[model samples]
Target: MESYGFIDCKDPKYVDTVKAIERELLFDGLLFRYKNNDDFGEPKSSFTVCTFWYINSLFKIGEETKAKNLFDQLLSNSNHMGLFSEDLDFKTKKC
Candidate 1:
């Protein structure tokens, strides 16, 4: 895909940029869309849709193994009925 209008994953600059962006968005290997607190100073948890997008990006960027692992973890976080919540409490491990 790099030859098809995609970023060159093997290029050093692109690789470094990808790593930097990943670091900024991920905490303890979990992805978050944002971390800023509201006016009440209560921060929002990781967004589940953002997490799914992150997993997809990982596969697109050639991190297949890690992406699969993260995808499995994300699935495990779903409710018993196979339902997913929008946000999660990372500390409490609650949805």
Candidate 2:
């Protein structure tokens, strides 16, 4: 599914609904699961997908510097092979 721009979470037709959901996810810091009643609850740091989305969002909102910083942080999370895996440990700084 398309996660970027006005299709899934940012649809204009559902602007209010989208914004509300985004607000909850972005500000309220909620982590949702793929299936119903399967929440992992709050997390200390952002997830891989969310971090990528944040970098994209920063670029989309014209915050290039911030986006670059975020990009660097995300890059630093990569393993020695320069690849990201399904299980990444941001704390230990390993993948």
Candidate 3:
């Protein structure tokens, strides 16, 4: 909803919904896409794409400073080769 400009952050409902989404999916500041339902069953970790999406949403919600800080943290989690897999370890800052 945030990506396609479907959400108007100025509106209270959109803000409430996004906040609820964030509250439900955010894990230790990282965003987890969803609960286990995939063929793989349970989730092993948070998806990197979701992290980017979360950051973008933060920007939309007027949290630029927090978004930038999280963006930096996300970059720091890249592997030594500057490579990223689908999943990242938030605690270790590694992929």
lDDT of each: 0.72, 0.51, 0.77
Indicate which candidate wins on TM-score. 3
Better of 1 and 2 by TM-score: 1
Q: Which candidate number would show the highest lDDT if scored against the true structure?
A: 3
Off by over 4 Å in 1: 1-18, 42-44
Alpha-carbon lDDT of model 2: 0.51
TM-score of 3: 0.76
Model 1 per-residue lDDT tens digits across residues 24-81:
8776556676667677574557777877877776786789999999889878878889
Clashes of each: 0, 0, 0
TM-score of each: 0.73, 0.52, 0.76
Q: Which residue pairs collide, candidate 2? A: none
Candidate 2 regions off by >4 Å?
Answer: 1-46
Ranking under TM-score, best-scoring first? 3, 1, 2
Model 2 Cα shift for residue 68 (angstroms): 0.2
Candidate 3 error regions (>4 Å):
2-5
